[model samples]
Target: MVGIIGYGVYIPRYRIKTVDIADVWGDDGEAVAQGLGVFEKSLPGPDEDVATISAEAARNAVKYAKIDPKEIGAVYIGSESHPYAVKPTGTIVAEAIGCSENMTCADFEFACKAGTAAVQTCMGLVTSKMVKYGLAIGADTAQGRPGDALEYSAAAGGAAYVIGEEDPVATIEATSSVTTDTPDFWRREGEDFPSHGARFTGEPAYFRHVEQGATNLFKKMGTSVDDYDYFVFHMPNGKFPVAMGKVLGVPKEKLEDSLVVRHIGNTYSGSSMVGLARVLDIAKPGSRIFMVSYGSGAGSDAFSIRVEDEIQSHRGEVPTVDDYIARKTYVSYSVYAKYRRTIKA
Candidate 1:
């Protein structure tokens, strides 16, 4: 079966509390934190960017897969915050991870769901025998205008997966997607930060798309929420996914393990991917995982994944998601502004 041979995640160590950001903007930190359900958010260091974050995650995946990088036939780096507008971020990642020159490479942008799109692409390539193995990464140094609500949630992180037909850690049973031309969020060509439709981002965009995508997948696979052992949904903030779980009839326990957003904020393209990694960290063999990722453009991609027995042998080959979460140094709003380059000279 074609599926994930290995996976890895990277979260920047620098974090800023939601309360600290609220204090800078003269808002009540407790109220804002309660409203968003996010206590803190991550930020990149002065040298970290999407490319570096992606490369690091990919290297970890390669290490976990225990395969020669030269065997990877395709590389896709998906992000809204790609370092170069003109060059493909995938090439840099491929080279950094020691991939051979003969592989195909490209960059994908679908806002927060771009990474899942990459994973789907790799799945197609491997299933078609067009590639022996493929690498897909979702990473972002997400942007937020100072004092905007997004400043509290826009964050940096990434995850990578190695996909192939070999003995995999998990096998993808099905995947589905739903898309529409709803402008819930956007950034113009020269705009420094994104703009959203406020309340419009909820019902008509994220919720509708995610619901439809997941429903379509359920219909295709003939499975219900109770069939899955774990659940992961895109987390723009801590609240949306929890609310979505209720709407989808998923048990709270099924989603609790994947709630990394409560501490790290939204990593844009990396959001649901990192959450999935967190679930994989503890899922047992034969566990079924239901995942749906929403992108604000807007759309959602749903996946049905079943854990394989191979996971037991590979556990702890690389640092777990909790390892990164625990290895943090808190920063103030001013320091966060400097690292994010939100403050101009």
Candidate 2:
């Protein structure tokens, strides 16, 4: 009976247009729009970091779950870009959320899919009666080399979900995980930005894992793609998921409602988790959701979710994606550089 009890999301107040990058780099504007499907990306402010953003999202999750923070029994932070190499960001978030001192806390990192991994792990803890409630968070401050195509779309945001046993808001119907021993994308120690085989990133990294993961979940669940009302993927940029969704035979009608890879760029670990939060907000009871998460060390996790009747009454109030995006303050490229810590004093 372990399932998600609540969910919340946070996107920074600053936004950088993809066109701003195109103008400075003298690149094609259409490529930025058509190829990527992202017009703007959320940018974290000077005072924020992975821990701070995770804390904010955790607080909101507490509100949504209608649970006292002291009752939380575990906290997990999932990120590829943790602020400290060794310290657990989950501890900082737990303190901010006011979770008990006895709570379990740790961090998980497996590229973009780490967030889903955190959710799976928390489910195990709650199902085993080890925890009354737990929180899983995905957050990142991704970096891209200046002038690189990735710069325009790799940005920051976070999402949080509370997992518990009874009175679940959404039930996890089934899940499947697939792995491949390949390097579709990677960044070594001391490297500020990741490197990728662009074409391989599509076929081998993103498409292959998502396809296999979803297929396995559908097979195991005795359901097909047509059974789900919506599909959400870990979108690094907009084009990859759109193209893959088309090839995978997901109904075009189902995809029109997706929010990933659109309003916000990829949040690395936060990508699919935030999409899941958005889906929870709009999905009707009895609707099935298919979620596919991919990480570049090359793995994917797929989960089938059924919205529960309980969600309609308890879905807590939080800022909508439209509201958050509308609140964004546009900044100059120079200011973007300064905020990103790319400017040399």
Candidate 3:
């Protein structure tokens, strides 16, 4: 019975309101905020690259897992934003988190779904006894081509999960996945941000993938969305997940507080896992949590998890979504452009 032994998350310290970006262009930020349900998005500093963000999340997860660094047998980093195109960010993260050299390490990419994809893969390694414990990290520093609508919500953040044998903190009961060759959003080589068909990204990319993944998981398990204590979805923006929930017959009441859209923006690869970490902060023993993640170029992964009695004891170590949101410092468009290195100094 392999499961999630511990979890952690990292959100950058800077924030930029949609209005701030809109204000500079004579556009109404209020309308954008209202439509997207996002007030601000996080921005990383020069020193905090994807590796650093992943390292922080791994540290927090290890702390809560109560496992020694040397005991970790594998590490998988999921990021489309690896700092170096040629080198592996997983090794750097393993070192930063103090994992042993005996561990297996690699990076995975599937857009935003890569994180949970790593989770599913790690579970396989543990269940098969190929390793004692494994770490899966989802981190991203998403770029939205300057002045694009994505620029207002595409953000940076990371989350890490430790997967191992049963008697664990959060156990995976079942899992399901769906994939299709859909180009709702994509970026070719040498592209900084992604390219999307705009309106198509919602129905074709996000909603379709998530709804199918969740429905298939629930139907096969013979359980409905109402049976779960909480639900989380990949939030590219606020509206997509909420809309998907409605179409899937998920109770509106169950989703209200769990949607992380307005507060954290769309964290690309880290979106759904980060939201799961938020729910873990308040989830009770015996609670069931359902999670679904979608990546553009389109794919979705869904999982069923049952919280253990130990969850309450470990929640204190991970920072809440609110904690991260409050510490953010604001930056103007000019400064944002400089930080992103989109402009020549």
* Candidate 3, 239-338: lDDT as tens digits: 8888888887778766666666687688888888888888887788999999999987889999999999977777767677667767879988888888
| True-structure RMSD for candidate 2 | 1.2
Looking at model 1, the pairs that clash are none
Candidate 2: lDDT of 322?
Answer: 51
Best by the TM-score measure: 1
Cα lDDT of model 1 overall? Answer: 0.94
Which one wins by lDDT: 2 or 3?
3
lDDT of 1 by residue, 1-345 (tens): 999999999999999999999998899999998999899999999999999999999988998888899999999988999999899999899999999999999999999999999999999999999999999999999999888888889999999999999999999999999988999999998788999998999999999999999999999999999899999999999999989999999989999999999889999999999999999999999999999999988899999999999999888788999999998999988888888887775
lDDT score, candidate 3, position 288: 93
Winning candidate number (lDDT): 1
Model 1 RMSD, rounded to 1 decimal:
0.7
